[model samples]
Target: MKISSRFTVAVHVLSLISLNKNVVSTSEWIAESVNTNPVVIRRVMGKLKKAGLLDIRRGLGGATLQRNLADITLLDVYKAVEVVEDGELFQMHENPNPNCPVGANIQDVLELILFRAQDAMEVVLKEITMEELVKVLSKKIG
Candidate 1:
């Protein structure tokens, strides 16, 4: 299964806020850009706020970035949105037959490989800051 869309939506929200600093980025406005419901934007914003990545205002005050784009890595957004449980990106099938040799051993052997793969993906994400992504996005928009 693919990672949750929450991660990408969070990235989109932050990018929009950073790029459009002059405008007050309400949930509705961001939702329009993301083509989703305002509730979805609100939910994602709440997670980002809890992670110290965003400062969400009450009522019409709208939201703002708590940290600079350069300071926030893609991994930060990924974790803030909680796309997956910690070290549990790739879940093994439940109730594999313990009586069968391969079934019993499969999870044990595969867990490490999956963890390594997730770690590698995280490393790449950590290296790419939101600033780097917004720069590319800005270039495309222009």
Candidate 2:
């Protein structure tokens, strides 16, 4: 399954906010930093807002981080922006050949593997916080 960049962009948006803790971050500014369109930033920001991760004032104002960076996890950002059917991170091929033995068992095997992979990913994501991200960014700039 192809993962969307919206998850990364969402993290970028939050990290920018965390980096500039003293100032409200406009979508345009964030978009410029992320090298994307402001509209795209706003759309992702909207999802984060809905997820209670951010606060965006209407028109002429900017966005603010609602929670401490240390309190937010990558998995939280993933959930905020990922639009998945049935909230699945991994997807199995649809309509595997029922006539073939490998095809018949492929999905079952895939499901077990995918479930473990998804769980592992979530565990890693949950272990990471935005605070850790900011420290890494600081190292890069300095």
Candidate 3:
């Protein structure tokens, strides 16, 4: 299953936003790091801003972290990027062979498994913070 780009960008965005020291970061730079469209970055930033994880300024301005990275979990970033808590993460294929009994029931079983997996993943994500990720990334990049 493919995690959305929203999750990727939000993680990076939160990490960089956490690095500022009495300074704001431009969306352009954020987008550049993301290697994506500025419009897309702005849209994601808007959601993060609304979630109180970030602060945005208008007119040649930039964004700043409104909350501490330690206080912002990966799950929080996922939420900011609009990743629903539903079982869609598994992306169960719709066309299970209807002829077989197991096939008839596979969807239900898969959905239940997906839900549980999602829950487990959410817990795991909550255990890590943007600050921790930034530290790891810094070490790796350094």
Q: State the lDDT of candidate 1 residue by residue for 104-141, as single tens digits.
A: 89998999899899899999999999999999999999
Candidate 1 worst ten-residue window by lDDT: 83-92
Candidate 3 C-alpha error for residue 40, in Å:
1.3
lDDT of 2: 0.88
Q: Model 3's lDDT to the true fold? A: 0.82
Q: Give each model's clash number.
A: 0, 0, 0
CA lDDT of each candidate? 0.94, 0.88, 0.82
Model 3 poorest 10 in a row by lDDT = 83-92
lDDT of 2 by residue, 14-103 (tens): 988888867769998899999999999999999999999999988867899899999999988888886554567776679989999999
Candidate that scores best on lDDT: 1
Give the per-residue Cα lDDT of candidate 2 at 113: 84
In model 3, pairs of residues that clash are none
**Lowest-scoring 10 consecutive residues by lDDT in candidate 2?**
82-91
lDDT of 1: 0.94
